[model samples]
Target chain A: MGKVFHEIRDPIHTFIRLDNDEKVVISSRQFQRLRCIHQLALTFLVYPGASHKRFEHSLGVMELAGRVFDVVTHPHHLSPEIRELFSQLDTDEKRSYWKKVLRMAALFHDVGHLPFSHAAEKELLPDEWTHEKITKHHILSDEMQEIWSNMTPPLRAADIAKLAVGPKEAPELEFDDWSTILSEIITSGAFGVDRMDYLLRDSHHIGVAYGRFDHYRLIDTLRILQAPPLDSKGEQSREPTLGVEAGGLQSAEALLLARYFMFSQVYFHPVRRIYDIHLKDFLCAMLQGGKFPTDVEGHLSFTDNEILVELRRACSDNSLSTSELAGRIIKRQHFKRLYERKPTDFQKNEQAALLIKQALEDKYGAENIRFDSPFQKGESIDFPVQLKDGSIESASSLSKTLNEIPVVKTEYVFIKRELEKEASLWLSNNKDDIIMS
Target chain B: MERNNQRTILLGMIKSLKDNKSWCGETHIQKAMYSLKTITNTPIDYDFILYKHGAFSYDLRDELTEMRADGFLSIEINPSPYGPSLAISESGQRLYDKYRENVSQYDPNIDFIATNLGAKGVTELERISTALYVCKKDNIFDIEECASRINELKRHVTIDLARSAASDAYKMLQEYEKHSC
Candidate 1:
């Protein structure tokens, strides 16, 4: 009999093939829970088509990671210097070992996300506890450990954990140089397969062209090369990192620009932001005892559908603050946008926005108003672009278009819909006092 | 005992900055502390890793919060182009003076770091500290190798900027060697 492999048809990646190991992970109760977790949370309320779940996204990431791994590790694709460094892993067996590990890491990356995704994270979890930390916990649990023990090579839970969270979060966790390169395949700041898959997958589901990018060309040009040391006292030893050839610079630009557009058009939509705040308020009230679940079992019991059902029950009670927030969402009674300031007016009119929020809050009550001011977007785009002449330069220095993209900051004052008229009139009359020259 | 030492080192650094009449932002403090520990070989244990800015320590952040609550420090969120600037409080200074004697052995190292790095802006400090961090992490001791590593780690930093950071880090290391001798 021919070797049988499990295959799932996906809208984004066409088909995601799973070996026995991957299938074992997918069939686990923890991984299956991701099906009920929405990829974009309440974003479906705005973009109705964005109802995709994390299950498909995890599979997509695994597939993209595999593609990138194959491209970077292939002898023909690697630069001469990089090839020499990987001489020990030259054999097909060693190559497959690393590939399997990368695929597994990608598959289990999002198993720790809480209900409603990022909306409830800040309120429900402790300040330092992120979804990545929870994911690491789950990866090291008895259930996952049992599965890893049964594998042919017996994968290390810590290795998978380090890759899932990346170097920024898991700085203390040590891994070998080659493993670091493999981990970068899934979680690196630039050219990570997680972002690559999400950008394309989110755009496809949201039915928008804003997040579309030349991922195919970008992946084809991906290569591994040593980055220069930071000081004279630094080691001269070559440390491999993920980078792209000069031909891929345009593709890289497209990927970054797509991220910027997606944040502006979809992720940070004003209505979406307010909905997130409401959802956070509800979750915070509901899970008041010790914030979030401390263990994997407590987390598995909660999902997107579970939370929605609880919200519906609370909406009928009317006594709870959670009920009031849930009722507004259920009845489509969203908060009114009392005032807004665009990026251009932010520098001159920030005080005006703040004063208006304070004045309106004093009159209407603090519970009825919220001032949302997001951090200014960062513009430091850093990625190595290997020139045709075997030299490398930062992509931002080479592309003026990349440097020209603006960092947008939007401030909004949201009021309860019933008090909108009074708030609007107060703002109109106090315009001179609120808005400073 | 180790935690106490870490706290003492932090307080001593803050006192040094206070003496210089200069306040720093969170990023500046983080990088400066990293440089101090690395250069002096002090046992001020803080797990710093390469973050977006450079070597960042969540432990240091938590410690600062605790110090603030205990009235040992104050963090003012005055708006600036870069971000908020953090300053030492009068109470913080008193605490530093009281505990600074505990870490007198490393006072020269702290003074060296504060005097050299105290007045620099957050961005330049980030570059230099990150340069030191990447060099140490990669075990690359050559100037050109260190600059190359930094440029790779921080793609936004130009080769020229990386070289400057490398030279600065080299000079600090030389000073540290001289002091140790």
Candidate 2:
């Protein structure tokens, strides 16, 4: 029994405890491969300290997910309405099973991320698949299958996949109520453990304060309350959801505020964004048919280590087709920010970057231009906040700060550094025409 | 779905909901879009998840926000503690007109979705839409079983509410079968 539990010291969560079964998971090759996968991808190129691996981030997520699972499912945390919905919640046996599954799901969630993580993810679709899908596949694969079955009570691969990737990404997978709520604990945009862990962990490693929040209070206050329908105020959906008490409203707002600041100041830093663009260019050129392998075996075979070796090789060898893009990463000759979306430019034309990108590509060849626009998740979270009156209100409506938090949207158009001066002059000359078009 | 097609169809639905419903908020459009795609022969693709409210699509939400940004949609912010409603902008109307033929075949479906769902409050919408979601997920049409399942899934929802919503979903299913494109 003494050997049944083990604890790993984590910077974010302090001590992340795991049982013997979970030890088998981390000891597996798939989980250990995370040691070679950097959490922020190539953000280290800009912030040298931002070199943490997915290994620790995954552990932190497991810790947070476990804590959140315990908090929201605890007897006191369970509202009478929630208990009525799932009588299974009354069972310690069932809660223990789900808690174990949630932790495992949290651990393996990002096992399928590509070497550079999400950089090439969006563009790879139609021809490829998402990291979530890959993670789902990994959880269901033979290697992990064996581990899950060896547990005291065997785990369902489907349950793990559903919780890890959530129903949104795994749209094809059917999620029952039991699975859906647990999945929300990990993937909900507002207060999911995944977002919570990444924000705190990334900020700590990247040496920024933007991602710090009162997580302890936030976690403690979480409950499976009934959320009414949002996007309108007159009616109640009375749906089960994970949220916080009124006391933690400030923490929830801070979490959203931190996300905004992090995106604006760190994740979307122009140099970091440009490095990703260059890395994507290098990857597409380096891979076969300019696509990451979709098959699990093929995807698992490549990590940042292997890709870095090839990147270095391509950097030194001028004869390689990808050498130019590779050198941009290795030698720091990445594209310069030629133009960024300004409020004035947006007021004139919403597709300002789209037009500018097209015109620039036409003038300087498509290969010389790169465009990056990251989607800003709307900050309006509808988690039901329990008020002092014992009434439930959507967080977005109850909190002034949450309602006013800005969505950090960015649109950057980059060009090969050599053409920056000429392009700048040319853009100034014809900018009005482009917006008018 | 084709880009222009999604834009035009969304415009048609937004305009329809605006005209039909007392308030055409983003949630209303999201639920309407789910029905349009799943119940009808609209050539669009969006992955629906049973979110806190009801069946929701993040891709659809993101696109709506993008449409608002790109002048295809406009928002009317309600007073504090209430969310904003959406309407198709002039540019959206122009684009809809330009691609009118693309969505013409699905007009009846869109109209049916808006008119039926528009007047319901968010709670009713949540129950009814989730009923539809259950039918879609499990391929089960038994209203009793669906209601029981919903009550079990969301205890806040009474079995009576679930049954009423399930009946609506079952009828909607029959209507779709009767009016299959």
**Model 1: runs farther than 4 Å from truth?**
A84-90, A228-239, A288-290, A319-321, A343-345, A349-352, A375-380, A435-437, B1-47, B50-181
> What is candidate 1's lDDT per residue for A64-117, written digit by digit as tens?
999998888877767776776564367887778778878888999899999878
DockQ of each: 0.07, 0.38
lDDT of 1 at A426: 83
Where does the lowest 10-residue lDDT sum fall in candidate 1 chain A? A228-237
Instruction: List pairs with backbone clashes in candidate 2.
Output: A229-A237
| lDDT tens readout by residue for model 2, A286-328 | 7887778867788879889999999999999999988888999
Q: Determine the C-alpha RMSD for candidate 2 after optimal superposition of all C-alphas.
A: 3.0
Q: Judging by lDDT against the true structure, name the best candidate.
A: 2
